[model samples]
Target: MNDIRLYLFQSGSQLCKVHDIKMNQGCGQDMEIPVPWFLLMHPKGNVVIDGGLAAEGLADPRGYWGDAIDAYRPRMRPEQGCVAQLATLGLSPRDIRYVALSHLHCDHSGAVGRFPDAVHLVQRREYEYAFAPDWFAAGAYARKDFDRAGLRWQFLDGEAGQPFDLYGDGALQAVFTPGHTLGHQSFLVTLRNSGTMILAGDAVYTLDHWNETALPGLLASAVDAVRSVQKLRALAERSGATLVPGHDPEAWRRFRLAPGYYD
Candidate 1:
């Protein structure tokens, strides 16, 4: 039996324009989607994947996120951050052994600093780009979230057969699937009885993108993004793994939330 377990936390939610979620669709409509984070427990160590919005935002959204809040306004409960969620299990940031970030976008990277003791895994290009993003790309990243002091970082460049297995055990693998943002990635987790699953971060915003029905509203490279979706979808099909979209309201509900887990 596998000793790995996965916990899904609903950190909070975000309100954005439908145009920002689906291309050429729902222009005037509003879309509210869950902001989620994952915790993986294995006999080897514990890991956190993009632990949602910062708890500070609950007190001061504008002060914390600044103008970025205008585009993706957030709504969060008090107990919905990395620290609070981990606390439920008698854990803390120091308890995390690794933090495998999909990318360093604001919403995704907000809780990074909390796990100072863990080795934070980031893509090399993603690290450089998020640090010095172009004018158009700057808003998506908030440096305060990641540019803190004394956090250990291990950079992964997209290499051939690029899924970097976390423990050399097929349990948690960070798959190189860029596109929505340069160096963006997805994850493949192998559960004992639940089977393998793909957590498609921004690389696949919703099922529409996975189905080729729509292009993501935000794309660093449309070509790269399209190829990524195809790659992830095909992998899921071949391996009989469930492909979870990054921010799909309807789809997100299908999963078992935290306080619950997939083992």
Candidate 2:
């Protein structure tokens, strides 16, 4: 049995009005981006990637954005959160055994509060950056949300290109592909029957960017970011894995969406 199934939970349909320079260059017709949350199921347990923005933060937009750029607004409501989406599949927060974070951006770590029991799998460097940030340069990540009591965690540390096996059997693996953040990582999942899928977090936000080899403006270092993208592209090609971007909507349209699941 190919007990693994991938689900797109939150479908954030918004036009990317900003450009690669982080300046308000007006809404270019070619700039719409899709922000998505993914859930992966295995016979052993369920694993969620990137928790999405919290409902509370969404309710008070000022709280989430502060003085950040508002050139683009999410078309989806934060209150219609990822947890609620998981509920639609008859799964609760407790069902998730592991929560794999691509990086600690507020949008990706917002729902961490919901899964108190799941062991958080993140890169050690990423966690450290989130805790003490250079707000003047790299901005901030929501580290306070992770201070919950008894929260279990697994940190990956080693050479940059090495891969971490989530299970000894090669069913799930985490590849360190830093650039978007110092310890940012991407996951490679092999289904019992569904083949391979690579969840390439913000390593490549859009396929267009990936295809063009263009780095996003928000990256800490453009040089490192491009190197990461090259690593991802090589991996996907060599392994024949379906690469899923962190915020690309076209990927949603190309996959089979479960009922009540966002496409």
Candidate 3:
């Protein structure tokens, strides 16, 4: 049997102008971007990547997101949280052995607290930046999502060229892809039947961004973003891996969701 399987879950969707995701274009165009998370089922353990909206955000947007709620209108339901979605797959937070966050953005790490037993992996800079006093001043990184006590935090050192092997069999690997955030990362999963798949977690919002080199609506460094895209492009081309974007509505529709999986 294949040692691992992958499932896609639609945690929530947000309404934002096209410019909010792709810079200098789609200024007046309104679109709904789908927020997705992945569940990697391995023989040894389960890995959760980029947990989406938590029950709190779906409960109260203004209370959780503040004034930014108007610009990035996040529409979520309590049932859409990671825990609830996992339950649909006959799993729960307790089943997850590791939670690898792409970045500490509010939308991505919202449900992290649900998996306190899992080893949370994040880049050193991303962890520090998320806790920096000025970090919350921008209101992008929500404290409630990550400040939970008793949660196991594991910092991944990119400077040492550490590519985290999720199951120690090289089926899943973490790829450093920083641009949208200072220390963001993507995932590369080598499946038995589906071949190689690179889950581009906000590294490239949509294929448009990957194709046209259009910078994301919000970026920490444009230069870094372009470089990251180039790296992912090269990796995909060389390995013939399918690139799974972070928040592309069109791309999201193509994936087979939980209960149904790619093995």
User: What is the C-alpha lDDT profile of model 1 across 138-166, one tens digit per residue?
Assistant: 88887888898898999997746668988
Which candidate gets the maximum lDDT versus the true structure?
1
Model 3, 81-123: lDDT tens digits are 8898889888867898989899898878965878757999888
Cα-lDDT of candidate 1: 0.87
lDDT of 2 by residue, 1-263 (tens): 25567776664554445463232343454456666677877777778888766666666655664544254455667545778878877888899988888888766775676885788888998887777767643334644566567778898883555788875667778888877788888888876556788888888876755785355656776677788888888988898888887766666578665453321
Model 3: lDDT equals 0.84
Candidate 3 — worst ten consecutive residues by lDDT sum?
Answer: 133-142
lDDT of each: 0.87, 0.70, 0.84
Give the count of colliding residue pairs in each prediction: 0, 0, 1
In model 2, residue pairs whose N, Cα or C atoms come closer than 3 Å (at least 3 residues apart or on different chains), thus clashing, are none
Better of 1 and 3 by lDDT: 1
How does each model score on TM-score?
A: 0.97, 0.86, 0.95
Clashing residue pairs, backbone N/CA/C < 3 A, model 3: 21-217
TM-score ranking of the models: 1, 3, 2
Which ten residues in a row are the worst by lDDT in model 2?
20-29
